[model samples]
Every structure is written in structure tokens, then in C-alpha cells.
Target chain A: MNEKPLELIHGEIDGRISATEREELRALLDADPKLREIRSELQKLAESFEKVQPLDPPAGLRARILTAIRPPEKPAGLAGWFPAWPMPTALRYGGAVAFGAAAAVVALQLGGVGQGTPGMDVTGLAGTMARYQEPGPAGDISAIQLNLNELHGTITSHLGEGLVILDIDLTTTRPVAIVADYDSGRLRFSGYAQTDDSAMSVTNNDHQIIVNHEGPQHYAVFFEGDAKDSVEINFRFVADGQQLHEETLKIPLVN
Target chain B: MDTDNELELVRRCQKGDGHAFEVLVGRYEKPIFNVAFRMLGNYDDAADVAQVAFMKAFENLARYNPAYKFYSWIYRIAINEAIDQLNRRKRNTELDEARLPDWHTPEQAVRDTQLSAVMQEALMDVKTDYRTVIVLKHFMDCSYEEISGILDIPVKTVKSRLFTARQLLKDRLADTGLL
Candidate 1:
């Protein structure tokens, strides 16, 4: 009835108990009929689990995973120039290189120097400079390169004062949608500006972004959030109703 | 596969050998899928979770510490993903028991399948922490030590949780007269 005897009983069942503890369990079970019944029912329950078969994973699951993990092949022509990812996006979720914090740090370095053109959500070369400039008071600014086909660029981000600054230099010849998915639940997309005057329209619906482009162009999008949040941005580029590339970028914010 | 064999395969994967990773996937996909299915009580969701687990493992291969068993590392990723899915379901109020797939059968076979389904539903009712121990111990056939290492908990805690989980499961099955 006591937790100790029950633990010993489980250890015995799992073959994890010492000989002495095994004896103690056996004696306890012999003395208490109720405990013995409980042990029998528990044994049956465990056996039921053992008898249950392991269902095979959905067919072609291995292929799907292999395709996802396999390095993206360099595209042919202009598209090839912007191949998916040069490497797996290496943003640590909770460490010093956290995604949101690093993005915010990049924002701090920009220091309002690069404002997007009015009516257009594009930041110009100055904003790009601000993005890749020296690290802010947060010590170091983290940069992540976006390699999705037809939308290749770099992102500089950092976290400070409960805000995250994300500067993106996305180049593409076709229409694409970029989405930033955050987990903090408190994430607020308060302000956004861009330098690439080529952006036909930039729309933000909570955590999703749609950026439509006409011809080949270089565009810079800047995002500012008032709340410090750690989030993963799933930048998916879709053209002609087909997904061209996908990458999950982890951002860790400092509150 | 032997530990050395798995490590060698992982090394090949690190060297950008997709085929080698595919081999590893073939080896462990079933057990990982079963682990998710048992924990979450749904086959489609289990499949999705299993795929995500493998993709995540491959994506973070550089972070894989060779100090632990490859299976343990992958299982930890899967269990975390399943727990996350469970949390999401809780938040969305989407825990639908009606979504459980029906098993085809004759009268007797149907009874047996229903019996199994009842057990799985009971498993779904257990708390995630306790269900994890039971799944590792009974479904995956992991040792107490292996379960502890996978969960990053003390072996004593593993034993206690397993005991308590089994009791909870037993109570549920007994109430339904499935025992």
C-alpha cells in the first residue's frame, strides 16, 4: 500500500530491483492480498501493452524524411543561384544565439537608420548596412542566410528592450510569401518596413506574411515587435501555387 | 543494429550520405511511430509526428551528441514533439475521441479490436508524464535506465512513475471490465 513497496514491486517487474529489494517486495505481496491483486492487475495491464503491435509508419515516410533532410540541389539558371538552404538553419532555440534575440540585436544595430520607403515596404542599402552592422549592446548580432530558391538573402536580427528587429534582404524574380511563426503567444507584429521598392504589396496577418513581386528585384523587409518573444519563422516561398522552398528559423528573444 | 554500426551510419550521414540516413530511418521508423501512436492514440497524427521527428533529427544532426545511444536521442525528440502536440490539442480543445480509427472485423475480431482500442483510449487519459514511462517500459521494451536516460530523469523517478502509471491504467481498465 505504501509508495515504497509499490515502487519495489514495479522495479521487480521491470527487473531493476536488487535481490534484497526483490525479497522485500515478495514478503510485502505475501502479507497483503490487496497489494497482490493490484500487482496482478498491473502485470496484466503491462502485458496488454506488450501484446499490442507496433504499427508500421505510413508508407514512404522514410522517403519523405529523406527528401526533407537531403540537401537541396542547386537550381538551374537564376533559380539555381538562390537554392534552398546552404545548410540546415543553425539557430539555437534557447542559447546565446537564440533566433528572436539575435534578430532584435540586428534591429538595435540598425537604430532607425534604415526606414522603408513610404507606400512600399522595402528598406534600402542603408537599412542593409544597419542590418549587418556592428553588434549592439546585446554583445553580438546574429545573422541567418535565407537560401530558398528565387528568394535568396540574409537576415540580421537581435533582441533588446522587449523588441525584436528583423532585417531581411530577399531577392526573387517571382511572387513569394514569407511567414514568421512565433511561439511566445505574446508576439505582436507592431511595425514593418522594407527597402526593396519592388515589393508590390506586403501584408501581415498575425504571424504570416505575403510579399508579391513582379520582376527580378532585391527587396529588404524590416520587422519590429514591441514584445520580446522567441519564435520560429517558417519562411515558405510559394510561386505558381507550388512551394518552392521551406526553412524553419528559430528566434530567441530577451525579455 | 549495433551501436557501432549506427554510429558509422550517422557518420556517413554527417558526410552528406542521404542513403545512410534512409537506412537509419528504415531501422527505427516503426518503433518511433509506435511510440507516438501509443502516446497520442491516433495513427495519422503518429505518422506526422514520426516524420517530423526524423526530419528534426536530420536537421539537428550536427547537434547530436555521440555520447548517447542514437535511438535514445531520436526518441527524446519524438517524445518532445508528441508532448508538444498534446499541449496544442489541449489548448485548441481538439481532443476528439471520435477521431479514433475503426478496426474492421468479424464479431469476435471486432470485439478484440474494440478491446484494444479501449486500452489505447485509457492510455490517452493518463497524464503525459506517466504515460511516457509506461510507453517506454511496456511498448518500447526499454530498460528503466534507458527510460531515465531518454527522459533525462533519475532512475528512481522512472520506477516511481512507472508504478503509478501502471496503477492508473489498471484502475481504468478495471472500471471498464477490460481486465
Candidate 2:
């Protein structure tokens, strides 16, 4: 009846009890018929669980999953460029990226400097930026911190292995959607991930990635950066189903 | 597979090796599927959850920390997905009658033993948190420490939840006269 006796019974059933603990449990059970009866009921519960078998996965489940994630096949005649990630146009989420140029294009377009075009609900990503100047590693870019009262965090870019990554970390009270619009001409959306397990979903295409979630989060958006000229990445933050803020960060290779 | 073997496959997956990922999928698909099935009590939903969990894992392979065992990470993802599904179903008011049949008879109890018996029904009655602990402890054959690691809870909490879940399940079965 006491918590101690019940815990001991579970520990005994789980085979996690020590010799001394076992002896202690034995003495306690010997003194209480109710405890012994309870143990028998618990043992039956365990047996039922054991008798229930694991269900087999459906056949070809593995193949279906593999095909979904396989490397995107390049369309014919596009030898130099691969148009990977041509996702549903219906979910034309925003695309944001400022990387993969021919030179040190320091086009640091923080929000309000010049209103970069917002992502597609109808309008294509358009936004003006300051002239390119800052030299970054592997054509990576960075952005100013978000200014939303409910949302707070900095968005920075890291580049490696032909991928330009946006490391977005934010803590928010209300639900927020981070829309990233990059130059489809220069990059293809590679992947999106949260730093830890959190409630988040991504809508992505070759040019844009939109991440929706609430609470503290560390999100990364990866794109295969392959721009030779100049490309811009615009990050738009939306809340309550409305665009609240937009900023830009890009690194261009002018080589 | 051993930890080293799993780690090697994961490393290959991180580098975009499809074959290596296939091996990892082969190894975990059934276990993950079963885990989801127990939580959802529906094969179709469990299949979708298992597939989606794997896709999420595959997409984030670069973020997989080798220090943690591969199965632990995958199991965590599966459990989270199942919990999310449970919450979504709650929000949508989608009720599975089998889980909560308004009528029950002694004959039905006899016809439906084990998988269809009072234990399965009772498992669904407990809170998701408690059911999760039970699934890990009983169906998954996990030790308290193992459940702690997978659920990312303290070992003490694992013990507490498991004990309470067992009691709750037992009571539900007793109420149905199947104990």
C-alpha cells in the first residue's frame, strides 16, 4: 500500500533490485499479503506486454523513403548547373541567402537599409542592399539581429562543402515563421534542421526555405552555394500570419 | 549493429552515402515502427510516423552527434513524433473507437486477448508521458537507465513514471475484469 513497497515490487519485477534491496523487499512482502497479491497482478501485466509482438514494417517502406531523399537529378542540358529541389510551387515559401559570388561582395542589407523584396505569396524575393564590400570566408554572409519584440536572436551564415548555412537561433513567445529567400540561380536548398528536437516544420524549394515553430530554437538552413556573379539572401520573419521583419546577409565570390 | 558499426554508417550517411543510410534504416525501421504502433494503436499512423522520423533523421545526419548511440537518437525522434501525433489527434478531436469502445462484454474480452485485450486499451488510457515510459520499459525491453536516456529524463523520474504507469494500467484492467 505504501509507495516504498510498490516501488520495491516494480524494481523486483524489473530485475533492477540489489541483493540487499531484494532482501528488504522480501521481508516487507512477507509481512503484507496485499503486497504479494499486488505483485502477482503486476507480473500478469508484464506478461501481457511480453506476449504482444512487434509489428513488421510494411514492405518497400525503405525504398520509398530512400527515393524521397535521393540526390536530385539534374535536368538534361544543364551540365554545369543542377536544378535540385524543385518543390511544390503551391508552397512557394520564401527563399533567403546571400552567398556564392565571384568576389568579396559585402552587400550587408540589414532590414530598413533598403527594403529587400519579401518572399512569394505572390511577389518574388526583391530587396535592395548596400554595395558589396566585406570579405568573408568561402563567400559566407551574416545579418543583423531580428527586431521583433516577441522574437529575439541573431542570424549568421557559415559556409563549407559548397553549402552556405544560415544559423538562426531565436527564443519567442508567439509562433513565428522564418522565411529564407536565396538566389535560385546561385544556390539550391540543401537541408534544414533544428539544433535540438523541437516542434518545427520546413517548406523549401531550390530558392527558398520557410521554417515554422515556436519557443527557443537553433535552426540551420543549408544551400549548395554555386553563384559566379552576385546573389542575395533575404530572411523574412512572419508572425500571426503576417510579415513582421526582413533582413539580408550574403557573401559573393568575385573570383 | 555495434556502436562502432552504427557510427561508421552514420558517418557515411553524413557524407551523403545512400547505401549506408539504407543499412541504418533496415536496422531501425521495425523497432521504430513498433514503438509508434504501440503509442498510436494504429498501423497506418505508425507507418507514416516511422517513415517521417527516418526522413527527418536522414535530412539531419550532419547534425547527428556520434557520441550518442544511433538507436538512442532515432528512438527519441520516434517517441517525439508519436507524442506529437497524439497531441494533434487530441486537437482535431479524432477519436479511435477501438481505443475507447463505449461497450464491452466478457465475450469480447475473451475474443480479444493480449494485443486486443484490456492491457492494450489500458495502455492508451494513461497519459502520454506515462504510456511512453511503459512502452519503453515493457514493449521495448529498456532498463530504467535506458528509458531515462531515450526520454531525456532523470533515472529517478523514469522509475517514478514506470511505477505509476504500471499501477494505472493494472487498475484499468481490474476495472474491466481482465486483471
Each model's DockQ?
0.29, 0.26
In model 2 chain B, where is the ten-residue run with the lowest total lDDT? B98-107
Give lDDT tens digits, candidate 1, residues B55-88. 7788778889899999999999999988886775
User: Cα deviation in Å at residue A159, candidate 1?
Assistant: 46
For each candidate, how many residue pairs have backbone atoms clashing (under 3 Å)?
Answer: 26, 23
Q: RMSD in Å for candidate 2, one decimal?
A: 16.4
Score candidate 2 by TM-score against the native: 0.56
All-Cα superposition RMSD per candidate: 15.8, 16.4
Candidate 2, residues A160-192: lDDT per residue as tens digits?
435565667788778777777777767755444
| lDDT of predicted model 2 | 0.64
lDDT of 1 by residue, A1-255 (tens): 468877776766777789898888889989999889878887787677766766666444554344334444444322222113323332111111121222222222221111342323332212211111223334325566866557777666654323455656566767665545543244544323333333233444445544554445443333344344456666666676676777676666653
Give the residue spans of candidate 2 off by over 4 A: A72-255, B94-117
Estimate the lDDT of model 1.
Answer: 0.61
Standalone chain B TM-score for every prediction: 0.90, 0.86
What shift in Å separates residue A181 of candidate 1 from its native position after superposition? Answer: 33
Looking only at chain A, give the TM-score of model 2 against the true structure.
0.44
| lDDT, residue A141, model 2 | 50
TM-score (2 decimals) of chain A in model 1: 0.39
